[model samples]
Target: MTPPKLRRLATAGLIAALLAGPMQAAAAQEPLVDHTPGQADIEGGATAQQDTNSLDASLSDAEKTADSVLTVDQMAANQRALASEIGPDGSSLGQGIERLATTGDPQVAPVDADAPTGTAAVSYWRPSGVYGVDVSSHQETVDWRAARNQGSQFAYVKATEATGYINPFFSPQYGGSEAAGMLRGAYHFAIPNVSTGAQQANYFINNGGGWVNDGKTLPPLLDVEYNPYPSLGNSCYNMSAAQMVSWIRDFSNTVVTRTGRLPMIYTTTDWWNTCTGYSTAFADHPLHIANYNNSGAGTLPAGWTGYELWQYTSIGPVVGDWNQWPSTLSALQAFARNNTAPAPSAGSAAITTLAGRTTKLGGATSGVVCGLIGGGCYQNYQRGSIHWTATTGAHATLGAIRTTWAGTGYEKGRLGYPTGPETCGLLGSGCYQNFQRGTIHWTTATGAHATLGAIRTAWAAHGYEKGRLGYPTGAETCGLVGGGCYQNFQRGTIHWTSTTGAHATLGGIRNTWAGTGYENGRLGYPTGPEICGITDGGCYQDYQRGAIHWTTATGAHATLGAIRRAWAGTGYETGSLGFPAGPETCTLVGGGCYQSFQRGAIHWTTATGAHATTGAIRRAWAGTGYENGRLGYPTGPQTCGLVDGGCYQNYQRGAIHWTTATGAHATLGAIRSTWAGTGYERGRLGYPTGPETCANNRCTQTFQGGTLTWTPTTGTRITYK
Candidate 1:
């Protein structure tokens, strides 16, 4: 029989895309097609003889690319790569590796009218081995139970092809078979000329070719057969035997280096011999040969003394390419677990970081595993664990600090990664570690704590350990009133509400706040930092409900509700009425409340609301029993700019008028009204000159313009001064 069955029909449209060379390879990749495999295969793997004349000029396209690495976006690009390399049968590329030993006109052996030439039925006597199947995207969803029912034991799913294309259906196909209790592995299809072998190997591993010590996951495989696209390039992908050998070695070595396992090489006999120059370098790697003869897998590749697996048929009895291992199920599993955890190498920095400290950390309980959120890695130990990232190096965390860190979601938490190791010798024997977010402090009394977010910033601004607030007493406690959070410290506490952010409270302000029940108090939480630039050496911190103004003379007190608003309107501590001197009290007749300030007091009632009374006018109102006597509460602010350089403040009943000569006085009853008939201060009576004198149940007052007298029987009579 002539060896080289002539090349024939291809999916012409698919092959035409290769004319643009590697650019097309790196361009938009096609996703895996979830469909049944097409019917076509030539014995030594040849194409069908139809459409031969039409592909004459197109078959000689020799596309090449620079061997430099690709600056690829692996995450987005790895989803798909349907290439010109896909064969007519879609799953079988071995046909392109068929031996080309023809001398006369190319000829194809005869087979069924519908089947591609050289297709033969399998012999009744099958090879004795653990059988399985290798599927690509074209197989879609394979019925693993059906395949396993056929006595198939394990499966290898195509993971990626070329540096550009990853089998999109990989997760379901690979995981589905495993979930069916079958040992599974991943494979990469090599397009060696497109990019360096190391790059493709990394892409494969990053996509799915990783290995765990689990017996259910098999070692990865490298499928390096013919180009499968003879129309695009030569059979060996436009490379000579020497270049092909170098490419195979690079791919094999990289896979070994990354996974710590020698990958199985799948190829056809004639292609392995012709393309690799029959190199013996990869004899250590298990070989999976592809042959489609009637009796058995035809011949061995040059390097491998014996074959480990076989892809026996493209027209699979079930869904995909049929595979068989010449060993039992247990032996196949044993190969998958070899050289599993190869991280933290003997001389590596991580190992050196833990050199003589195993006593403290205890023996390792887990391997150095990576692929962290920030590219960090960690190895667990009996007592503790060592965490490593490019920026943080390797550091061990254990005990309460580690427990607290774990409680915070580890590296994925608000603290992110640790920037430094735990440092002790702080006040009260406290220890702290700086992280991307903040710090976690631990002490014997406090146990362990984490200070984070705006709360941490407020603490740092105050002086941290040496400030009025010492080390944190506990982790930041959240979910308080109004979605607020607070953290207690050795000396005081810092509070954070969504609307207020964070602020520190210490000394008398804290005392009064604690007395009022802290966050649940009338003041709620502090909305801003304290300011001491007041009239006196006083400071004040504003809170949600009110404020606490502190001064050496008046101490600290909160003025809340309407009373506080009245004080704020009066220019706060810098105004006529100074800082608050006492907590607001509601013990008044008629359910009225009042807050005493440095200079005066502000009173509020259900009927009159809140108003401030200060200076000489306030004393005059106090003499009249304040809100209990004639004038109930001041209705307005103290008004100046009256006649004769005078000032007057209105009240619930009457007004208290003050001036340099008149001092301060109040007007009341009928005799005071008769003075108002003459326009009082602005009219003939002008300003009051003397207090109203009373005797024998009668009262009288002398003003600058006149004197008004009153009796029990008669009202008032005005006598001109």
Candidate 2:
């Protein structure tokens, strides 16, 4: 008996011839004889006289008279006849002979003609044209060359199962079959219960399920059948027929998407009908049926028009399962080429045509149809894609501009579908693509930019590239404080907060806004468009928290929060406190805030809201240490007409008084009461000469009419001259 490895070598030689080309027809004149035990004799050969009880004498008279030098058609018929006798189980005269021949165990007793074969049998119906076999580790190693020489025309080798589990014999069997000139394909045994169909398909393709359009390679095959669970009594596992069908479809679709070739289906008729409910969705894919009964090709699973390859018997001239393709070699080759070719779908025809016309796109690298988004299709290439839409037709997007568009959400994003092809030779040798919603611009200096919605409208109104704003430099960004969006331009920025709508800020106003921390500063976000016709023809833009006022007089100043409100209350620049003279300064004396205006200045502290002081009143308050001095932040605006026709403003600590008699002076505590009692400036003791002269633990201020003094020990005293 031949060793398993040696047998495999011999088989490899036989199968190699089938893959290389058509087999040479055997000469009709040669006489043939069966040399092994349990053998048959061919016509024109002398009969061997052996004991009837021995294996060699078991052949029927009809088998003994079979023709030895047979045509391809004749060989296919004989294989089918023998497979019918074996059936699905290893029973009958045919299976007995095959087991004795393959395993070389002559002592094993033969089963009755109608008994089960223990092993699953291939279909019995013989296909009249080409023939082949599928193999796995179960066959150990195959004599592929011998199998091909004996009339096998093609082979499908088991490659992977589930996510893991690779067939050890796959490499040798695949190479041996291919080398023997057989049309070869790889198959995956799907375990849908263990993992998803897509995952298994990916694993299968990555391992050995992939196929090219080379004439010798066949499309991949999927082997989905009875579940391998031992404890379960049913073959369908826990899934219903519909679920099984869905699993099979998912696997087939995934395989087609990755390899661009729909896989052939390998399943028995009963399993297909019962487990998959006779699903017809996969009718377009080729079928490889396994039905081991003698009924021939009378019935098939629903959906399939006819079978391509039929696995007819577990035992063949070689030591592996046998199959047959019911067509001539030329027809088989054409089928392979057609199935592996790029087949167009609904919207893909236009994209396919576009790709053919464009030289740079090369060929499509992916088979995913773009129908999921828009009513279009896209075929991706090395550089870009050939995008097709019913309305926009077909166009090509490539290079940096394409990259930029993809960054902005591709077709599903704000840009939507490409309306026009990429155009070059713009202002700076740039390129751009127009989309349904907006346009993407690209240049060496600016890279690629997207401008859309209101921001784009504003940019266009400003003359776009020719205007002061120049070209856009970035995509529009949202999620601003006031539901606003913004995009940067070459010369400046366009802001679109809710209150301000869409507006552009440039030059000094832009600079001043930046210095004040832009939107993040005390001014917050812009609330309204900038106004140009304020007091002195100044421009001011309102913000969420306050406003920034700009003019030739004040440059640009931001007045916000309490101080801004105080200024607004005074009629802004039109009333007393005119345009801001300077930006608001805070963290001042006594933790106060202040801003200077054309008329006067407004100061505020936590204790004192905000009050304005001007002219001599402001000077008087400043002299008294302002908020930090004896007279703190003003408690009220200045008022005229005291007892002596003087003006005074109250503060947190004291008050400042001004009159013609004594300019401005701060009168506080007991001195203020004493002065007021003496009729202040109206009576004889008029305004004080100076602040206060202190010595010998006494404080005194000499009035115009008399001298007033105070001490802790003496309380108060007045000296009149």
Candidate 3:
């Protein structure tokens, strides 16, 4: 199908899905702001402040009852309200379709000297194996050993273009490939308007030829994206697909004649149709395609067997690995060979680790250090069990240190054992006293070692936590791996405010808090110098303040707990909610709604649903009914506080119209709820001016536009205004 056709289908699907869900309602228990009932007073101190505020005369629970549920008639009204906001000229659909269908340009290149000499073997295409680089645009260095350990063998480095225009991102990737010791190749972006094929070839040959190793270099690739002709601003808009194909062909042929390497095409699917007509002009050559979703391949023009490489998705983090690309090294090598057949090499030796120490049975010994104090290293800086070692022989002892994860992550060492105490005798003072101080003594034949105060307390061990102090402290702390005292001095200690009930805290010089429940009904177990106390009190039970008034129950019918107004709460919200950094709007009590005013996203509370906007931008969109300065207001039969899709279901923006799936209608932004099962859920309003559906008890369920559909399960509700 054409791009336009596909977009139309997508748009329809999106619209259908939007209209079916029910609008949610406002929260019944809009938490009282800072109400401290019968707060106890300290002796001879100021009295505790009580919550005092006039009730909103125009706003009450009963006043909102009428606007809660949305009827089918209201749905139509919502559609009309949004009609003007969606599509060009208020049409039912936007721009008809996404794009038109067309032909892509044919590509030609010099026969690759590195191409396999044997006849190309036909093979079935299957999505198997990993394809990734040892280094990437983000990493400045690469570890060959680590790469090899992670199974990396193939690499792609960035190259240059002619006309003096270079890829803004280079240097690091170019050098990292060598550091990684992976088989390598390079590619140049087809810079439209500036560099012709010859220019690109000359630039690459001059700056990138060294990347090839005999026949090992992967085939050259051409990145062709946006059209580059400056004079064709809108010209390409009306140009036939055939024309686009011609331009690409001209560019392709120029580079091939100069480089003596087959140039593969790298482009998006839409660009393919506009320039290649999905024809066989370059059918024999490899094609690297970037289709974020796997669903679009079947729609490829006829005669296309399969892509040489496919970038199916982005942003995947595999365990024990690094790189933004989605595939692994072995898979990359296979993909380079087009998975026709396999060649063999013995796998690298296995690495053994104990107690957080590692050692390769046959790996070299030059990098090991022997004097490390701790047997295991942690990622954070805090003290742990320190173990010192000293070498005693010519063939020095070699071994690895293990971390909590049971891996040999780093190396350690120590000097040869003392030849004799007399050989190091002069190191001590001349005071020849030798007296025991407890179980140990600082003494020598020549003199007693410097007084106890002279010994420096350096960190000898580290643990899995971060930013721990030297020596044992009753406070919670952990150390980072590699024997650091603390991860960084900056993230020292994170303190929180007082909280009611049994709130636990971590303690100990090692900062181990994984265990559950406090000892003796206290916050955490005391260790060394560390101790736990109530949030409002100082460390240890001694400094705890007497009971505060907020703890007293106000009775069964009365509401309790913190409630954010205007904006929602997120990330340790203790005081009034603050403004966000993005777009926002505000609302008045009864009417008046506007859109598109720059404003800092804000979180505010109102006595009677007053209109206000304050945040990033100076100006604010105007509206009402708990406007968080977002798009619209919340509407549903159930109390808005109901949690759905990981966010509170009741939050909504105020008075802004956008195209709803049902047609043009007011756009009611959905609120994310922390209580929702994994992610965020959508909510809407009941009343509007057009053909749209408001959320309600009858229809609040996520709909598939009458057909089954998938929505993001993980959503965020921690929005401000």
Candidate 4:
């Protein structure tokens, strides 16, 4: 009888041939293995199992004869007879044999390189040799204990690949290897083209590459090889040999820096030589050489005098890449121990003490240290930094305070160095950090803020910390309108224009300025800060357009644009029109604009420039519907020092005059012509005491000097004094 393995192989071959039919004839001639370079390198080489059934006593007479010369029809008949052997209950005796025949063997065949072939009978661990296996997700479920029992001393389980992929099988394999008393390590499959080498290395170390100084754990390995991504084009990842070398160096250095241990470099001889130009710069690091030809590692790659591990074959009893370590296990353990020794603590006593104080904040003496001002040191922490000096004990700077300090360049910045730790529970529920140059304050309402330079100097003069402005709410920001900068404080804001210098704006005056779009609107930037102690405990601020004036009686008002220029011509706030009582009201009567002041108001229209009307003169103009009335817009400003101690303002069609005795009245048309004829106010008619009264085609005005009348019958009649 044929052996069970050989019999199953024969039956499976027959079934495959019957399924293929005419295609089997063509397929039988082709080689079982494709010896393509990159393609064949993956999962070792291909070795086909031969199907031989020379000895078999169970064959029937007809089947025996047919096996020698089987046609498609005969094969079909045999398949039908075999199918009936599968009963409803389960696989029959014949069907069970067929199931075993189709399943085949699970062992992957080894590459047919010119190496000494070994079976399970051969001892994997020689007295002089150490052995391990490198595995990734492709290995699936592994009996790690069985592998350990087969003389495997160690295992390097793949942890991460590229930048984002993590091996799903890593946890089980790593834990099983360690549980089985085999030394275990983790490795990353390097994909330099996918991301920066440093970033990938950090991801690797953070995931599983980190190693404690345990003698049972091996140093991490970086699996750099031919590009597995052929679809991306180029076996060398489309990079030049020099670039590949730099990428490898960057990855190795980053791994070493992050985890206090140097990583072993794994590569095939040809891959290293071709992709990296056989660079020998990494001579000091350990090498893991892979060579399938198996002529004793087949000429080790450049830079590696001797390799720590050699992947001799892809097919092994452990179901992974088989590796052989030339050194003994103790030497390997020592190598792992030496590379992962803890780093030394910081040298400065102050920094060391600071580290102890800030342990919960992730501060450590082993962190990066830099010189601080006046003979001191500063150490960095995950959340913040600690500055130490003889004068000031080490203090942590974090949160908003740290951000403000960083904006000014930390210790080396304009703030120089921190003088004290942040102090809380200040006025307004705020916190502040003092620096050599200035201070940064923070509150829940305003976040962290900084103030310095000329702006800070001006704020300091106004009592600063104790002033109404209180703590700063924001940093000094520049590039404002008219090439200026401003800083916001709790109660007010300080602005500085090149021409105006530094000044503060507060209360109502500031609000009015803001209503005009601050410095960016028609008013432009503030020419000067708010100046108080004016006409009536009022305040005023000058701007490029005009000025904003505030008083308890008039509130705050902006006087700008055309009406403002007109107001300035009238001696501004110091004149008859004291401080602006109201903002300029535009689109008024007949498209006119007007602004109210302490004395009176200035009104302007397209038809008339701008003119002021005060007291009774303003009242008389209002009675005529102001600019919209028949008198039209004001032609000129109100004029006083008339014939008596009176005032009059000219209009398009009429004029309004005022006196102590005659109040104020408007005189126009024929009544005004008749009054002029009577020598106006200088003549018999002093100033019109009352406006022209008309009835039944007759009009008359009662003046101080005379009464002027007009009629259709009598052209003009004057009752002079």
lDDT of each: 0.69, 0.66, 0.30, 0.66
Best candidate, lDDT: 1
Instruction: Report the lDDT of model 2 for residue 520.
Output: 70
lDDT of 4 by residue, 1-721 (tens): 1212212223444433333455445543432122212312211112212224311222234333322223334334433533343122211001111122233211112243212332212433232478888776766688876786677878888888665667777788887776444678998877555455677788888878877665566888888764433222133443444455666667777877877778888876555654555566677788887654335766776667898887765556765467888877666656667534423334256666666766555834223233334655555465776776666566678887887777666665677667777888976688988887888888888888877877888888777757867778788889986789999987888988878788777888788878989878777777776788876687888887777888898898988777888788878778878878778888787788888888888888878888888777888788888777878888998888986687888899988888898898888887888777767788756777778888999888787777777899998888877
For model 1 the local lDDT of residue 634 reads 79
Residues forming the 10-long window of minimal summed lDDT in candidate 1: 33-42
Question: Once model 4 is optimally superposed onto the true structure by TM-score, how far is the C-alpha of residue 443 displaced, in angstroms?
Answer: 3.4
Candidate 2 residues lying further than 4 Å off, grouped into runs, are 1-189, 192-374, 377-398, 420-433, 461-463, 478-485, 494-521, 574-577, 581-583, 597-600, 640-646, 659-662, 678-721
Question: For model 3, how does the per-residue alpha-carbon lDDT over 489-597 read when each residue is reduced to its tens digit?
Answer: 1112222222221122223211222221222222232222233242322232111211111111110010012111233223111222222222223353334232221
Cα-based TM-score, every candidate: 0.54, 0.51, 0.29, 0.55
Put down candidate 1 lDDT per residue, 1-721, tens digits, no spaces. Answer: 2134224335444334433344546533421111112221111211323222221212343222311122233212222233443533233334342222112112221233124322335532346777888887767778876886676668888888776677778898886776444678898888765666777788989999877665466787888875554443445554544456666667767888887778888887666665555556677888888876556777686556788887766555566467778877556756666733444432236744663555678876444545556677666666777777887777777788887887786787888777777788987788988778878988898788899889999999998887878888877888898898888998888989878889999998789888898889888889899888777888888888888888888888988888878888899888878888888899897898998888998988878889889898898888888989887777887888999988888888887888889888887778667877888689888888766789998899888877889987877888886
Which residue segments of model 3 deviate by more than 4 Å? 1-128, 133-157, 177-184, 209-211, 214-216, 228-260, 294-296, 301-303, 317-721
**Global local distance difference test of model 4:** 0.66
Task: Name the lDDT of candidate 1.
Answer: 0.69
Best by TM-score: 4
